[model samples]
Target: MQDTIRRNGSWLRAAGIVVAAVAVSAGTTLPAAADTDSWSYLTKMQAHEMWKIADGSGVTVAVIDSGVKDGSGWKIDSVLPGVSYIEPPFERPDYVYPPHDDFVGHGTTMTAAIVGDGSSGGPKGLAPGAKVLPIRTSVGTPMAFAVASEAAKGIRYAADNGAKIINLSLGWTPDWPMDKVKPAVEYAQSKGLLIFAAMGNEGEGKNWTNAIAGLPGVIGVGAVDPTGKAMPFSSHGPDTDLTSVGSKVEIRCAENKGWCTGNGGTSFATSLASASAALVWSAHPDWTANQVARVLIQTAGAPTDGSKRSDWVGYGVARPRKVLLDHEGDPGAPDVDPLAAPAAPKTPAPGTDPTAAAAAPRAEAADAESGLSWQWPALGAVAAVGLGLAATVIVKRRRS
Candidate 1:
C-alpha cells in the first residue's frame, strides 16, 4: 500500500519506485538579469566568496543525462568533445555529443547548473570555469532498458577520459536491482572519479523506494529550500550524503530556448553537489578525491546541536564557501574514502522484502497509513534507483 502522489497534472504510483518527469509550475519570466532572478541560487550559497578561491577552472565533470545543449553565451571551448549513447549510429563509437531533439529539458538544465559561464545573455554556472562532459543516455525515459546499458558504458567512458567528477541525475529502481551497473560504478571509483547522484523526487509522492542511494563511494544528494531547510517532499530516512538548494530552480532548457523555473528534484541538487566538488578540486589541484569527499562531509553545515550527520539533510547543505573561505575543512587522510559503506557488498535474493531492506526508521512523519490501493504501472526501466534510504544511511553500507 504505497502512497500515490499526483504531480504536474498526472497521477504517479510509488509502488513502481521511479523518478518521473518534472513537476512544472507555470509562470512567465524574462531572461535572467545579470545578478538577479533565476540565478539567485548562486547568491544564496555565497558562491562568490568561494569563487575568489576556486572557480572550478581546471576540473571536468561528466553529466550523465538526456543531453546537454549549449546557449550562445556558453563557451564553445569549455564544453569538451562528449559522446552520446542515444540516437542512431550517427556518432563514432568512441566519441560523440547530443543531437538537438532532447525530449525534455533535464540534461540541459543540469549542464547550466554545473558549469554555464554566463555570457552576453546567458545564465552563470556555479562552476563557470569547470568543463562539462555531456553523456546522453537517450531522448527520454531514464528507466528504459536500452538506456541502462548506455549509462553503464557512459560511466566507464567518462572515467577513462579526463572526467574528474561524474554527476548522475537519474536514479534506478530497487525492484530491478541495478547489479549490472555496479561494475561500472566500481570502475569509475577505481580511477579516482568522484561520483554524485540524485536521491529521487518521490518524497511527497508515493514515498517510493530508491536504489544505490547508499552505494559505497557514491555521494547521494538531497534537496533543501531557501531558508536552508529540507523540503517536505525531499525523501528522508538516510542514505543521503548532503543537501543543496533544489526547489524552483531556473535553468536554460535542453529542448527549447530560454530558462525553465519548473526544474526541481535531487537531480538538480546533485548538480550543485557536483559543482561544489569541482570548486574544491580546482582550488586544491593536488588533493585526492578522498580528501575532497572528507572535507565536504567534515565542513558540511549540520544541526545546531552538533551531530555529524542528518538523515534528510545529510551533512546539511554543501558549504563549499565555508570550506574555502573560512578554511574550515579538514583534508584528513588522502587515501581514506569518505563515502564507504560499513558492510561488505551483498545482493539480496529475488523477492527479498522491501521492509526488511529499509534499515532505519524515517526521522520524519510515521510511515504512510497503508490502506491506499492503486495499480502499479509497468515501466521497464532499470535506471530509476536510490532513496527511501533509511537502513543504508544509518547502518554502514560499506565496511569501516
Candidate 2:
C-alpha cells in the first residue's frame, strides 16, 4: 500500500513508515540563501537556540536507514565508520550497498537532518556536533523479511556501539506484526539507548498503529505541519508519543545536485526528535535515557486543544527550548521509564518545581524570525527550489 506519487513539485509516498526514494529536480539552480527561519520553531523546538546550550558534542545518534553518503554538506568528520545489514541482490539497482555510499539518498537526508554541517548550502542539522552512526538497511524493499531482521540486527549493533539514540524513520504497515524486531528493541532499551520511531503516515483512514513505533520500548513520533497542527497524513491513535514539525523542510537528496525541499511526513519528524534528544544528552551527559525522555515529554507544548495528551499530536509538539533555554521540567528519577504502560508515577526531582514549568504558556505557531533560525555564512543566491519529494515507504512482508 505504499505507492509513490508526484504532487506539488514533490513526491509523497502513501504509507508513512519506511524511507521512500524521494525524487529531486535534476541539475536545478539553487540560491545560497540560508534558511534563517528554521521550520522547527513552528513547534518551538528551536534548533539554533538549543545549540547555544548544547551542539550534541560527545553524543552519537544511530540512523538506521539507507546508507549515509559523504560530501552532502554534512559534517563528514562526525559520521562514524558504521555497520550495514544489507545482503546481496539489492532490491533497487540504483542503491549503493556500502554504509557510506547512499544512492537511494533517504538515509543521507535523514542523517543531514540530524547532524548536517550546512556546508555548500546543505541543511544545517539540529545537532551538528553529534556524530551519526549509519546502520545501512534495505530502503526500496522495506517490507522484506530481510529488512526486519536487518533492522533488528541494526538496533543491537547500535546498542553495542556508542549510539545513545537510535532513529527509526522506517516502519511496516500497521497490521504487519513486528515480532521479529521486538527483542532487539528491548535489548536497546536495556542498554539505556533511547529509540525513536516514526508513527506511520497513512492518516486516519488506516487507523492502525505499526511497529517498531507501536513496540513497547520505542517512542512513537507523529508529524505536524508548520502551523503546529498534526499533518493530515500523519498517522494517529494510541501509539503516538510525541510530535514535531515534519513538512516543507530542506534536505540533501540523491536525485538533485542541490538540496531539495521535502514535503515531510513522520520520517522527518523522527529525526527532529532524535536531534532533540542528542542535544539534551550532550548537555547532561550524566543523565540517563529515562531522564532525557521524561524532560522532553514534560517540557513539550501540551496539545493545542488543551488536552493532557492527544492521539493526533501525542503529548504535543516537542519544545526542547523550554528545557535547554529556560531549564524548566524536572528530570525526575533516572531509573523511572516515562512512557511505561500504566506509566510509572513520577515525583519531581528535589527542589524542582514541575508546577511552575507547567504554568508556562503553551507554545504557539510562529514565523521565521520567531523560530530557531540558522545563521549560515554569506553564501550569495542560495536558492531553495520548489518542494521536493518526501516519499514514505511502508514495510509489510508478503503474507501467504
Candidate 3:
C-alpha cells in the first residue's frame, strides 16, 4: 500500500536519490520523523475538522498486511487476536506475537494511519477510536513473488475471523486472480465486510496490477497530493472507485523503531479511506456494507459526469466528512452487493482451476465487461448548493 511520491517537477528528480540516501542512512531504523510523536503529527484539531462527526469508535477494521506490533500501544486495546496465513510458528494460533517484533514497520505504520490515537503526537487516524484486527502476511517478506499465497491466505483468515471491514495495502505484479479468492471475498461480504485495497503504486510502470480494486466488492483507492492533485505515481483508471490525500499525508513509517513519520502513496490513502468507512459504519451500525459504500460513492467529492472521472483521480476524492455530516445522504440497499458482476460465473465447478480459467485472455475480457459500476444518483442541486454553502463557511472560518 506504500510508495514514495516526487515533491513536484524538480523534486521528482531528486525523489529517488533522496529515498535511496534515506534508506541507506536509516538502514532498518526508520527515519527520525517516522516516530509517532516526532514529525508527522495530525493534530486532534485537524482530526476533528476532518472526521469528528464520523469518529469510528466502535467499528472494527481488519488490516491484512505484514503483522502489527500491538505492543507499540498504538492499537486500541479491544483488538482481537489476529490470524496469520503465513506458515506455522509464523502463523500463530493465538493472536499475540513476539513483543515489538514488527519485521517491517509497514503494518504498524499503516495501523496507526487508520486508527492511531494521536496520543504520541503521531498522525491521528481518520477513525481514531476504531478497533483494528491485524492479519500478518507479507510484512518483512522478501518481495511480492514470495508472499502471494500468504496474502490470499491472510484475506481468507481475516474474513473468517468476524472482521466487518478489511484493509489491504499490499500488491503483486502478476496479480493473483480474484477467482482464486472470490469465495473468501464473497464469504466476507456475506458477513458484511467492506474491503478497501490500494489501486497500486505502479502507475508509471505499465505492469502495475489493479486486481484487488478491480474485483467486485472491493473499493479501489488512488492517491492525491495535499493540494488535491492526482499523483503521477498513483495508479488510476475506471477501476478506481475513489481518491484520497495520498502524497505528503503524514504517517508512521516502517523504518523507525516504534516511531512515526510521513510517507505517501495509495496504500496510505487506502487505509485512510477504510478508516473513514469504519467511522461511518460505527455511527450507523445498522447499515449494511452496501449502504455504507453507497454513502461513500454518492457523497464522494467529484464531478457527476462519468467521462469526467479522470483515470488519475477516479470518481473523485473521497470525503468521509461529507458523507458523515450530510443529513440527506442515502446509505443504499442493505442486501445489495456493491461489487457483484451479473455476467460472471458465480464459482468454478468441482475440479477446475479457478485462476487458470479466469486468467485466460478471453475470461479476462469477460470479467472486464462484468466489472462494477457506480449506480448512485448524482448529488442533487439542493445538496450541491448546500455543500457549496458549507464550504464557503469553512473557508470564511479559516480566513478569520
Candidate 4:
C-alpha cells in the first residue's frame, strides 16, 4: 500500500539535496547533471585492482530507489523484472516506454555505482559483473511515512527475488515510527540479505541516529571526500557502522545523458559499500551473509581497534580492496548478526505518533550536499494489504 508518487520524476527534499535533473530524450542511462568537473572515485577506491580477482559475478544487488533502466551504451545486465510501489496517479507517465525511466535517477545512479560497465562512456560501477535487481520505491519530499512503508516493501521484494546484497540509499527521519520500517528489515535479514543504508547527511545537524541505519543488522554508512576525510554532511552517531568515499563521486543519470560531479552523501557510499560486499561475496560463494559481512568489517581500514570507533566514521572507511587482496579474515560465525544485539519489535512511542509529527523539517538529509537528516512528514493516508517489505528488512536488522 503506497501513495501515488508524483510522476514529474522528481524527489526534491527540502533537506538541501539538489536533485539535479538532466533530461535526455534519446539516451538510456539516467537523470541529473553537475556544475562541477568530473571525478574518478572508483579508481581512487582502487576498484580496478580488486577487479583483477573479483568482479562480483555471482552477486546481485537489489537497488531500492526510484527505478532502473540500463541506458543505451552502458554494459549493464540481469536487471530482473522489477515492481513499482508508486501507485497509478503518480506512476511514471512513460511507463510503457521503458522499465527504468527513474524520476530522480537516484535509483539508477546507485545501481550504476554498483554494477555499471564502463563501455557506455558513463562512470564504471564497482562490481561490474554483478547482477542488479531493481525495486522501485518512492523517495524524498512530503511523504516520510509513505516512503518508509514503500521502501520496506521494496526490501522484501529484493530479498525474495534472490538479491544477496540489498542497497538502500534512502532513510527515514529520527522520530518517524521505527515500526513502519522495522518489520520488513527483519524479514530480509532472516532470509540472509545483507542490508546497506545511507547514514543520512545530518552529522552537523542534531546528529541523531537514523532509524533504519541504527537498526541491528543494517550496515549504516557515512561519506568520505576525495581526500578520504569524513564529509560534514554525513549522518553520525554511535549507530553508524562504517564510512566510505562518498565525495566527488561520479554517477551517470538513468538516461545516460549527463552525470553528477562531486556528489557526496551516505547514499552514494551505501551503494559502494553494497557493491564492495558483492565483490567479497562473489569471490567467496560459500560464505554466508554473516561471514561476508564480518570479513568486510574485519578488513575495513580502521584507525583504531575494536575497542574504540570514531563517532563520525564508525568502523572507518570501507576498503573491500583490503579484504579482496589479503584474502584472509576471520568470518567468525556463519549465523550471527555483527552490528547489534537482538531486540524485540518496537511499538510506536506515545505522543510521538507518526502522523501527528509536524511536517516540521527535522534536520533533513539524503544525498551528500549539506542535506538534513529528515524532512517533516507530509500529511497523506495510504495503505497496503501487508508491508512484506518493512517486515523483511526489520527481520534482518533485528536478527541476533
Backbone clash total, candidate 2: 10
Give a tens-digit lDDT track for model 4, residues 1-400: 1223342333333212332221122123222233232335565556778889999998888888767755632464546677777644434444442336554455666777777764444457788888888777655333334666677788778878888989877755533455646788789989988988776655544443355776777887777664545666566655566777665556543222456444536777888889889999988899888888887776666534343345466666677777778666788889986665553554655766333222222221211111110110010111110011122223233322
TM-score of each: 0.75, 0.75, 0.69, 0.74
The digit string of per-residue lDDT tens for model 1 on 1-400 reads 0111122112123322322322222233334453254556687667777788899999999988767665535678767768877634223333333432233446676777777766644556789899988888752443344555777888999999999999887755443335546788889989999988777665655444245555677787777765566655555535677777665566543234566454355767788889999999999999989899889877777744455566667767787877788888889788777766353444545876433423433331111000000000111122332233222222335322
Candidate that would win on lDDT: 2
lDDT of 2 by residue, 227-309 (tens): 77776656665567778777666654334245655544677788888988898899899999988988988877676556667
Which window of ten consecutive residues has the lowest lDDT sum in model 1? 367-376
Model 3, span 95-134: residue lDDT tens:
3333233444556666777777655544456677787787
Ranking by lDDT: 2, 1, 4, 3
Q: Give stretches of model 3 more than 4 Å off.
A: 1-46, 49-53, 71-78, 88-100, 143-146, 175-179, 258-260, 303-308, 338-400
**Global lDDT for candidate 1?**
0.62
Mark the 10 consecutive residues where model 3 has the least summed lDDT: 369-378
Ranking by TM-score: 1, 2, 4, 3
Instruction: Indicate the TM-score of model 3.
Output: 0.69
Model 2 TM-score relative to the real fold? 0.75
Candidate 2 residue runs with Cα over 4 Å from true position = 1-44, 90-96, 141-145, 174-177, 254-257, 341-400
